[model samples]
Target: VAVTIPVSDDPTLPCLTFRFWVLATIFSILAAAVGAFNFLRYNQIALTTFAFILMSYPCGLLMAKILPSWKIGFYWPSDFLFARGTFIGGSLNPGPFNVKEQTLIIVAASTNLGAAYALDILSIQRLFFGPNQNPNNVGWAASLLLLWTTQCLGYSMAGLSRSWLVYPAAMWWPTNLVTANLLHIFHSDLQQEVVRDRLAVFKKITVLALVYELLPQFFAGYLSRISLVCLALGGASGKLGIAADYSPGRGTGVGIVTLDWAGVSQLGPLYTPLWAQMNVLISLMVSSWIFTPLLYVSDFWNAKSYPITSTGTFDNEFRPYDVSRVIDLQTHDLVVAKYDAYSPLMLNPAWAIVYAAGFAALSATLVHVFLFHGQELAEGFRSSRNPESEDVHVKMMRKYPEVPFTWYLATLVIFAALSIFLVEYWNTEFGMRWWGVLLAIAMAFIFLIPTGIILAISNATIGTNIIVELIYGFIDPGKAIANTVFKTYGFNSLHQAHALASDLKLGVYMKIPPKAMFISQFYGTIIGSIVNYAVMDMLIRNVKQIWYFTHHSPLAIDNHWNAQNPPVFYTASLIWGAIGPQRFFSGQYSVLYYGFLVGAIAPVLTWGLHRRFPGSGWNYVNFPIFFQYWGKAQSNGFANCLVSGFAASLTSQFWLKRHHRTWYDKYNYTVSAGLDSGSMFTAIIIYLV
Candidate 1:
């Protein structure tokens, strides 16, 4: 019954730095050289799945270190950075292409859930769970179409609420601040000659570096494996072996084994501001390096049998738990006879702690927001009713006609019909019923405002997956796949709404025409949906390692896709979906469910301290955002990646900003753009070649 929760943890990258091409060139060489060797020696690319994504995280960090805030602005072809690269890639086709926000919005609107979560869902249902059939072979096209319909249903719901969310200035989706600021370098009057020149140079450098990674991507497949730890330890270090765990790809530990950029960079430091990176560093060091190691050594959860940091749970014998073997095909219930034989759930102490922190973060976010901005939020909703009360951005947006709510209503109606077919007519054996979809929609409605409130204030977000999954975990207890389906409807739509609202907010900030934004988004939606579908299909077909399980063992791991948070997702689903919170989180794990209450109360306590001791800096105790960093390791290791990132920011943000004000202003974001551009260009090139 284990299923992955398809929630997007929106990270707030402070747009300030593009600092490091100096190291990028070196990493590029390593990637190329090893990529070439691997191809020649093994006749395969050394790194196949999402190598580019790994490289961008560090590039941003490196850039932020060298570049002061004012020094530079924007990632090269900035639109191409981040998860939005798919649409940006389609739009930024060579020859004077304008990477307009309107165009980006269009692509974004088109790019739906089909691109990201569908493959994982199908992989879970078919490869890992039941039938062991190729997703492409059975009702695959219909499944995709149906999923897209559900996506539209979510988008339509978001559109209907635009008047309340988008028109309000206080509902400033913080993530869009980065995007808006970068886009302004071109669209706004602030386009400086220096900025344009830097962007041009960066663009050229990106293409060259990207092209060079071809060697590592194709020929020298070994270049991506510049793991000094693996080489030194021969990758055979036994139980609790730190050396074997240091490398990016090889290790179960959270330290860096090599300086290879291809192997190490997973945080997008280039676009992230220095301060945020510092916070991340502090959190990861305390948790991953210090806390995680201690817990693992202490046999936390009796976890010494497994890796110190992993997303997948294992049995007593340390085997990957196969829920498919335990799930009843007909009733979709847990086979009670087989259940007792199954291992009790065990998580890497790091992951378990992270999940627990996530729970805290969820509650902390609500309390913190209420304490800090409750007045402003109340005013924002009122502002929609009284146009004169609007914020500056919304007022400026008034000149342009608004995108009518009718468009959204129509979209919802159409998509809801499609979803009905998916729920009732589609192969029903799996049991994603009509009521589940209705429940999903209802959950989406309840969480949207609170989630939106959190997103507006802090670019940071905790996924609705926890809330939505928790709800369905109780309501639809034994229906594993149905639970996942319901979750996508409930959470993904809310996430999609946030994105839409973010875009609308960005438009208001830049004063883009609402009608134009709507049209562009609609067009982009079409383009993104089709292109994402094609790419997903291509990747699934070509990368069998990602879609298919290679073996049946406790450590039946898929290096490419499995590492990218799906296993973590599977664990989440197992806890809330299959096992249900009652038994799975009961007794020793009871705290997991009650985490919501703890999170809520913790903030109130902090707020009291702040109000009572105004001068004591109690206000700075931001537990929610602080706790958010705990769950980051499941995405990237903390040791070297985090420490180096922190160092880079410390000098630039704290030291330089304080003492060397002139230097800091001149180069703050410029340097980050350089390094990030170099790194990503290398990855894109590597991926292409």
Candidate 2:
């Protein structure tokens, strides 16, 4: 019943800078080291969870890193609003009820991040562990809870820069790089066959498009500004009996959406909560359960046609699903595994694009880094295998080891120095230049560090927009953190794009036709994004009050999973100026400390809760619900949240707990990726309308 319209008063619009980029690079490297180490120390489950975290907020960061167009892209509807929380564009931007806007951003980022991570974890587990294994077991749940709680605490302690934990830790594209290399080395002969088949399809398409269609059109329209070349000069143009040339350009004119927020002041207040709640539902529940599986399954079927199963049936590692078995490690003998194939349109094109882009960028990044800093990758990989040694990678460094303790101290010292130095060197329109810098530094160190730490533990690092919001606060102290973070992180819209990119890379590795994969994924992303957008808008508009509670009010709070943006702790940040349970760090919210308490005792809680309330119609033991209400109270609203959470959390657990443990015995990752895109798209359309 509490209509809390969450608004972001922070105004620090820190766009891309050399320093920021450099810092991000360092952060990413550190995160990657952490992720690889985790995989070694814990298991693939840990890596998958971490990757999901990374997908949440800085999801845009992934795209920003990979895609060319989204560099200066806008965030959410708030960007349309001006200083006064009024619209700037008459009909373009959604105007603002400041708090409401911020709340939606935070909620969407958090839910999306969690959903993506959940999907990734399940998929990975399904791939390695097997179909019969129950990943939702006490051990897996305990580990997951432990990690999630740890990350939450870490982020809380460091003020919540979630990216430090999720991004590099998840090893997004890096994992693909490793996977691709492995395939190339062991599955070279298999690759040759796939490459041949793929090339054949590509050639066929190219000829059809070029000869029968393009060549004739090009000859016809040789010189106009809007060239008619490549235009279809067929009799199918409208109802006309005569043959005509259609002048539709493949290039889309509108690059990014621009909104006008001024005139929508009245509309803003009315729609804020509505849209916010819708985003939560679409980004979280609908996308997770309904869409993800569909996309994944579709992709699996597409790739199933060209199998790569190993031939050694008697070998101990003989897995029914081990497609990589085609490569005879010793003999290098290759066996081409085949299944019923399908046409290009059957595949999810958008997912393919995401895969391709991610694959290319990751490959490019690795090449560039190796060429420029080969020693670094080698060192990092070695360090991962041996954490105790002061290897060559660490030895060749120009910078000495700044112990974590020392790093914090230095950060503070540097911040103080910069505050003074910048004040003398530069002038600001605001009188609080020195104060602002100090505050910014304070926010970064105080808020970001702990948030990052906990996020690392939880492995949910994608869009932890706490840093972006903090930066926004430092730049513009008057606005709320939510608006700033959303504008900064969500504006990038990177994850979806990155997902598409990664899929394309999968196609390349599988030897799916390059151009076909490109077309499918490109179209898929466009279709997915548009559908997602439409459904998202509908949900937001129709579900008015739901947004208010979900985004800001305590009613939005859930102890089951990590829903409710500007979460209970974030809300406390405004009041106590400290993170986690107490104003300082105490066991006041021990029940909420998922890692130490919830995660550790999850098995017990699962049993106890169910035993005490037999047939109560609530399953607290489930991963989906367990995660959702880990730190919050449990109730009915948690129903839908648990649906997606359970489906995503349990699916892999069901498969992995009883299956093999390596890529040599894995499920199709491409399938999962596709399902997530397509199903989520379809679900969004259904849910929103």
Candidate 3:
């Protein structure tokens, strides 16, 4: 619902108009849960998931190209014309699109997508592992039962307070899953193997040293006060646009923090991005193109650190080039060839760094091997390119020793200063004639500082949009920038208006060809923007009276889903710290630095916690919701807990399971993309209709 227009007479029809659909989603969830369970147990092939993946590229490309080609553009002079990313929990007033209905549909689709993931993992095992391995061994039936039971409880509760269905907190299930993955990785057997080696002893010691020094710092202000401060700033500065006049009988609409179900939906479209399609494509293309090559380079160092084997995959063993085979002990036709592993130590660090520089390069390599490379290796054995026949160029890149810690710190300071300057530039709207562009460039540094630091530190990745949006808004608050400085007489908004330019720069650091990345991302964003806007407008228009902000309405978009509100809370906090009014503690400016602190130090913390007290994994695995005791009234506590357990257990089992190896292994990549693309497609379809 975009803007809630009230209708007091009809109690059943709120402004959102789709509350009934959300209620109906309970059935969809049930069906999906059952389907997912059956698919996982039986190792079923889901054409739906595969089709989505295969079609993603073509659809995105076509959509991007068609609109521009036909010049059938939905131009918005205002800043409200952005694209919706995933529909389930997007912002409400995302420019011109309010797509709450489509968002719910995507949420339903995601439930099914989860099922696809379960089954896909099994399919992988079946393809790669021998047929005898049990795909059903992962306790699929039990998982489904748990999911169903918890969902039932949630639905019953929602029925009692029907307004709880559309809140953002209600969508915490996915975030929990992400947190669970981090927890599992932190305590996985894989890390145990790394620590066992004599050569890696120094690495372990370094990790330990860092953890001890950083843990207290991490907890001190980084996790607690920084986030809260930012949220508060965003809320207080009117940056979030959440009404502050909630004094009873005094014309203060209810505070956003206290907004009801439909109210929270206003924030939905913030989840939308102009470049989602492009981002997905870039992620995939880089993974397939650049990351794959980096993985090959990784083998030079890693291939030799471990033994060389010929028969088994990385899951069963981490050995390089398996070559052993037993033929019933009769003919003994099996070949026993020995190949030497590459030694990365002999390679130049410069070369190694170049090879390893990509988003999630290491994780991508490992995941690709775990799910995909294994099958490719198997295929190589069966093909004409035998080990004895050809000199294959298969090498996994070694881990690059990063630049010294000092370099990252310097960058952080520089960026923070820059971000501050950008804010000043943006303040020109309030009569500060300070150069906006320079300030924007400077502020961009603040974000870049920690983004690089944490990313380089523990390889921890987090969203960078908070800084991006604030800076963009500050630098170019208007919808357009009329300047000839950056190449042409360019006209683009400070934020999404310059998406092409910003992404072009990002693509450069990530090793993507500037032109291709620019084109792909721009194409995807524009196309997605139109469709997202159209669908959102339609849904909001149809449900206008239901979602507006009013006393009688069950849900209101203004206080809840608007982009200028919730996220603004954080932006304001950052600005306050830089300015020093609300900045009480010494670490006020250090808030952005926390991103680096958290990302860099997380691995060490996890390791130390595990060492000091084993089984800390299970406890720490439940990520506490910071600040708020009860997140947006719509959130289901049980659902998040259930999803966390399910994601971890299921992911772990897929890694361990022998059967359905092919499917199980490829689950992560396929499912992430599949759901994203499927929902995008559904959104477009809705727009078209």
Candidate 4:
């Protein structure tokens, strides 16, 4: 905290002024529109909060300079209903733009910067499922309700868990540290030599990255994934058999490297801690290089018949699983007789292992947090009640009125009821019972703290989607839409809770008023959801071939609108929902059930080892991260940038961090932010041109 985050706070700064709301609203709409639009493309890009930070600073400054300092006041008429004598006043410009305003703008804009998770449910239903498959048939009211409720339900969890997740010093969200530092650099006085130097470096790197990105991104596209093994084998068509399964573009990338900054930074090499990065790299290496090949060569689960790595599900005859044949279009439910007569669902080795890893990671997160951070959680709860033990940042934030717990409770209660209403009233479209929504909320509430703790400490998260899918698939068998709806509520609620907690921490660090933070984030969510639904609905209705594999559409490939996420989401529904985990988890894939046992036991063993060898770094083993990344290649193809990612981590987090502390502290995060901004802008410009 001392090295990266500023310890002091200036409480006199103005926040939530007229300028803030204007900028926040403008950026939030742009972010939502761009985010939702890009979400359907093959090369998905987001206008990140970091980019917002960089862009908003200048805009805020420009507003402060140009706008007149005019204060306006409004007084209620004497016969007004509620505020008979109340007066409200504000200014066009709130003096000079400060860090507090900048921080709040970033927070508000960021909430809607990415496509909401609920969009996945809506998209899959429209593109692949019955009734809604016709774009015009999609229900806007149901879609809006689903988007709003799922997006906002998590705020309640975040507010309720603030004591343990946000106020604790030990729960210092590492990612926020970088954000905090960048904010300070941008808004701080530039007269200081160190600040000036850092800004110069940031600018230089931004331009360099923007110019250098064109080669890998467009001109020399092969530089994005250069594989010596694939080159040496002369692109032979299975001539060398299993030995030639290392194509960076097509197969598991064993000896490959990516020159693209966007690809290299996918795993966050410059910001994530070294230990966590190593854990992910180690798991990826073992699973992709050694274990996956051995299973394929041995023809495990008839893996030789399918591609070395694929997200698609197949049948007994090694053909792409035709989901339409096994489903009754009239009811949107699986036809058991047709399914039984046809071949059972089969997954490639890589995809199969991804499910197992997801299972293990979920369980491991629960165990790891309980064993390692149990005492800290208890301490944090106690300290939250006793203000004397509050950290410096929290103490500084005490001047601002905190958001009331009742507000969060009301939010949770109201939206949760709305969610149930949607699923119940729109059962034909949603395909889930009212009780399923409650069950999903219960599961999300139960797992929020443990997963939040994991994210807060390690800067890595384990999603509850897999487990949610499994449980709901079993409970509501053969109903794919129902299973997905349950997964969205159960999984996305927890994910949003963590995101809110992280933003809350940023607020605390920046000394913004808690209530202001709440208002901005809540407003952003509503606006973003509306924009997301509008953009998605527009594309589905207007574009005839927006869905993948329609008319063998070249637009999907050339324009990078291939619809990658929906297809994967559709396949998952087929595997865990239509097929039912009961049938899928038995037979040839019965071994996957052991993932739970392995995940639960691995953390216990690590805890013991840490107790036995206190100084040997056993505590950093982090089984959850290892397991989560073990099968990462299954969904994210090849991961050709692991080598470059590791090299970047070594240089920034290890070498500069140890050898040149001053420079590292001043410019490390700045470099990461600059590179990201440059690459993002370049990608957008390239797409437009």
Each prediction's Cα lDDT score? 0.54, 0.28, 0.26, 0.82
- Report the C-alpha displacement of residue 49, candidate 1, in angstroms: 19
Q: Give a tens-digit lDDT track for model 4, residues 176-293.
A: 8778878888877899777788788888988999889988887899888877676777764353232333442256676678889989888788888899889988898888877877
lDDT of 3: 0.26
Q: What are the models' TM-scores?
A: 0.71, 0.26, 0.27, 0.94
Q: Which rank order by lDDT, best down to worst? A: 4, 1, 2, 3
Q: Tally clashing residue pairs in candidate 3.
A: 82
Query: CA shift at 597, candidate 4, in angstroms?
Result: 0.4
lDDT of 1 at 468: 74
Off by over 4 Å in 1: 1-114, 123-145, 157-279, 329-333, 383-391, 427-430, 531-576, 615-617, 638-640, 656-667
RMSD value for candidate 3: 30.8
Scored by lDDT, the top model is 4
How does residue 33 of candidate 3 score in lDDT? Answer: 43
lDDT (0-100) at residue 170 of candidate 2? 25
- In candidate 3, position 141 carries an lDDT of 36
Cα RMSD to the true fold for all candidates: 12.3, 28.5, 30.8, 2.8
lDDT of 3 by residue, 1-689 (tens): 11111111111211122221332243344335434333322122232322322333233334334432221224334345575333232222222111222222222322333332112222222222222333332233322222222122221122111111111111111222221222122222454443133223323433443343232222232221122222666654232211232221111111222111112212211121112212222332333224323433466434333321111122113432222231112211221121113211122211222222322222232332233224333433352433332211110101212223354345334433443343354332112233543443343333322222222211223233333333343343321111111101011112221222222222222222222332233233323323322333343335433233312256554332221221222222222211122211122222333433333333444445656788555212211111011111112211112212223334433333355655433233223332333333333343344
| Model 4 C-alpha lDDT versus the unseen true structure | 0.82
Overall local distance difference test of candidate 1: 0.54
Per-residue lDDT of 414 in model 3: 47
